[model samples]
Target: MYKHLVVAVDGSATSLNALQHACSLAEMSNAKITLVHVANPSEYMAMAPEFMHHASYEEAAVAQGNEVLDFAEKAVQEAGLSDVVKHLLVANKGARDMAQELVDYADEQGAELLVLGTHGRSGLMHLLMGSFAETVMRQSHLPLLVIRSQKDEDE
Candidate 1:
């Protein structure tokens, strides 16, 4: 019954799955869907200096973020949802994490629901990489719908 839903997309399969769920819900509820992608410049800063120029790293990050948003928007449109908005969130010089930016945007948008996808990592991988979805769940005041990645058993 939510009117406005914000979805986090990172150009990953898991995130696409979350988009699919959001599309279904949006279709049912006739709600507006806002797709948010956070471009963290710090991620590019971590690259070895010899590999790429410092300034180019930030440019690459923003470029990739735009590409991600474009792809997500296309998917939503293809899913027959026209009430869609896209946001490219940039994390300013490591001032905030992706989750915080997303949560803040959702709050600013007055979104009734926030959706995300989880890679479902565990143990060492989970501990090392950490989970943004988990962080958003903890930080967001709105209701959250998490779509977990579908993994093959064989691997």
Candidate 2:
């Protein structure tokens, strides 16, 4: 019953797995798929002024995000799904919480389901890196499907 599906990708293997799963689900349900990549404002701000000589950090991030989306879109196309939308979101509104931005975008796009992958990092690593999927799962009211980490296959 998924009408609109949103998949968050960041070019990682885990994210790619999620994308593949989302594509399959979209095909089965005849759902329109939206792929989104969020760039943190803090990362842009962290760039020194010298780093912006040729292009602004925001522009660079968007370019990279587009590349990620492009790869994901190609995968969906290869899977025979033509209805795909892509968003390269740069988080610049006040706080730079990516999970919030993803949830906000999904809500704005009226996505019936949101899919993402977990890296499965726990303990201190999880504390330092934080878990995007976990944060989104905690905050999002929409239906979420989390693809476990590739490492999970080994375990």
Candidate 3:
């Protein structure tokens, strides 16, 4: 039984599904849920035009991350679980990737279970975009519960 669970949320439907699953498990075990959203400025920068301001982009990324965490926390509370913690992690340049950050945070939180949603991309797409869930699984020392994207199944 898990006493503490760390879940990654990115304001995506898949992430919401993962949070829902985490809530169910938390209810069963009376575990505390720690919701984490990584704000990777580098990702935003990569997508932004060269003329865009870095400071504004970073701020936007952090703001979005906070919004995602707030939404996830509300969902957890609405699920009737009060023991919830939210973290907005900023991914620095030349540092660990988002997956590593999540894994490290889970370990720091002393979580028994790490939960996340995966887009389930395969073949060319998977190779090009890579799988965040897969990276986390490889780096994490604790148990992981991966919830595949419902959209993928629907398609």
TM-score of each: 0.90, 0.88, 0.90
Encode model 2's per-residue lDDT on 1-155: one tens digit a residue.
89899999988888999999999899899999999999754567667787764366677778778889999999999999999999987786532378889999999999999999888888998878777788898889999999987865426
lDDT of 1 by residue, 17-89 (tens): 9999999999999999999998987787777878764368768788889999999999999999999999988
Clashing residue pair totals per candidate (backbone < 3 A): 0, 0, 0
lDDT against the true structure, per candidate, is: 0.88, 0.87, 0.88
| Candidate 2, position 75, lDDT | 91
**How does residue 74 of candidate 3 score in lDDT?**
94
Worst 10 residues of 1 by lDDT: 90-99
> Which tens-of-lDDT digit does each residue in 1-155 have in candidate 3?
99999999999899999999999999999999999998987767666476564457788789889989999999999999999999988777522477888888888889999999988999998888888898898898899999999865537
RMSD of every candidate to native, in Å, equals 2.4, 2.8, 2.5
- Write out the backbone clash pairs for model 3: none
